[model samples]
Target: MKLSILDQSPIPYGKTAEESLSASIELAKMADTLGYKRYWIAEHHDMSGLACPAPDIMLSRIGAETENIRIGAGAVLLLHYRPYNIAERYNMLAVLYPDRVDLGIGRAPGGSAEATIALSGNFLENVSKMPETLDELLSFFEGNFPKDHMYSAINPSPVPKVSPEPWLLGTSEKSGILAAEKGIPYAFGHFMSEQDGPEIVKRYHANTKSGKSLVAVSVICAETTKEAEELALSSQLWKIQQAKGEGKKGVPTVEEARAYNFSDEKKNDKIIAGNSGVVKQELEVLQEKYQTDEFMIVTITHSFEARRKSYELIAKAFGL
Candidate 1:
């Protein structure tokens, strides 16, 4: 099985954005040396908790810092930027990093409504143009557009010897169908929504030509199951804040979570947490259910060191 990291650069309760970003770079280097497959950064705008608003810039810095593991945007909110610009930036990254670039795209706004407007001037218009934007992005990679197409007259450049591998990141059947139609890799954001992951993976494999499937999930690993559960309270509290639209700044500490008094049902609904053995068991079950060999972990905790150790434990568990 292959393991990857999808870092949102979550700003812990006391850490600054600079510290969070530095942690991301350090984590990328760690993953590279630990024999992991990929280190993908997320793009989230106007979220004080998420330090990475520009994944392209982070990818460039991470690419410079890592040697082997692929560096990429976990999901660049494609609707916010021009297709040609997106194409050029990623292709330029490919030029800098060669075959070690993965370009994952998503249609989500990646921010609040007002921030979305600030990003693209018109969120709805950009959302409506997503399909065409995606097509134009792919055309830049293919270096050709249909003769009658308006983009046929222009080509996005410094096309690398190998284009960055494109993956559609989504949580539903629509995303599966689109990725299948496009014939690229597909990633299911199991951590972002309550959608049925096994079904999504099943449908994606059933429809895709390449049969590539990736699941991004929330995982917290510790030395013991009890310790893991305790650490996970913070994530639960963070989710509660997000649900209430109050968690836009930073991830809360474990103490904050304990004080929040989240419902037991809500705490049990998500978060795969335990010791290495238990985490491995849960992941193995997921692998069997999805019939895939890859899993991308998204871990957010109060302490940077704990977050780093979580990945380390998971990597050790998986023998990655």
Candidate 2:
């Protein structure tokens, strides 16, 4: 199995955004040394817990700090900006980093309802235009704009020797279909949706005529199964709050999660948390079910140390 990481650059309680960002860079370096295949950063706007609202900037810093590990956006909210703009920015990064860049674009608003409106000025209209925007972005990369298209007369400059590898990110079957139709790589957001994993992967494989498929999973690994369970609770309350549309910016402590009232189903869904051996076993089951060898793991923990340890333990378990 090829294990990769999806870092949110999450701010733990009482930590500054700077600290969270610093931790992300440090983690990227660690992942590079640990033999992980890729390290993708997430973009979340107007969220206190996540510091990486601008993955392009973060990618530059991460790429500068780490060697050998591939770095890119987990998903840049495609609805917020012009496709030409995204294409140019990442193309610039590709010039600097070459084959190390990956651009994963998604249509979802990466923020609250209010922030979504703030981002694009017109949410629904911008979302409705995502397909066209994706086409424009790809045209810039492939230099294949349709005849008479406005951009056919123009070129996004500073084009790298190797263009960025673009992947469509989605949590539903619709995303898979669009990706397959576009003939681009598809990354299933398994971490975001528990019920849709098996079906989404199946559909993506069946429909895709080209490009590989990847799944992102939420994982928490620790020294012992009991300890891992305790640490994993940090996300239970956070998940509950998110469902209530009251999710906080930073992670809740295990103590806070223990104090909150939550059903077992919500707490366990889409999460693979346990000791190294247990995590490995659970991941195997998921891999078998998804029929994919590539997995991008997202870990949410209260402490930076714990988060790093989680990845470290998992990497050791996978022998990556």
Best model number under lDDT: 1
TM-score of each: 0.96, 0.96
Ten contiguous residues with the weakest lDDT in model 2: 261-270
lDDT of 2: 0.87
Tens digits of per-residue lDDT for model 1, 147-227? 888888776678789999999999988888889888889999887777788887888788866769889989999999998
* TM-score of candidate 2 to 2 decimals: 0.96
Please provide the root mean square deviation of candidate 1 (C-alpha atoms, Å): 1.5
| Off by more than 4 A, model 2 | 263-265
Please give the lDDT score at residue 106 for candidate 1.
95
Q: What is the C-alpha RMSD of each candidate to the true structure, in Å?
A: 1.5, 1.6
* Candidate 2 per-residue C-alpha lDDT over 1-320 given as tens digits, one digit per residue, 9 for 90 to 100: 99999998887777889998889989999999999999999999988678988999999988898889988899998999988889889999999997999999988888888999888888888877778888889989999988888889877778899999999999887888889888898999888874567787788778866668889999999999998888888876676777776766678888887787775445646788899999999999988998988999999988899999999999999998
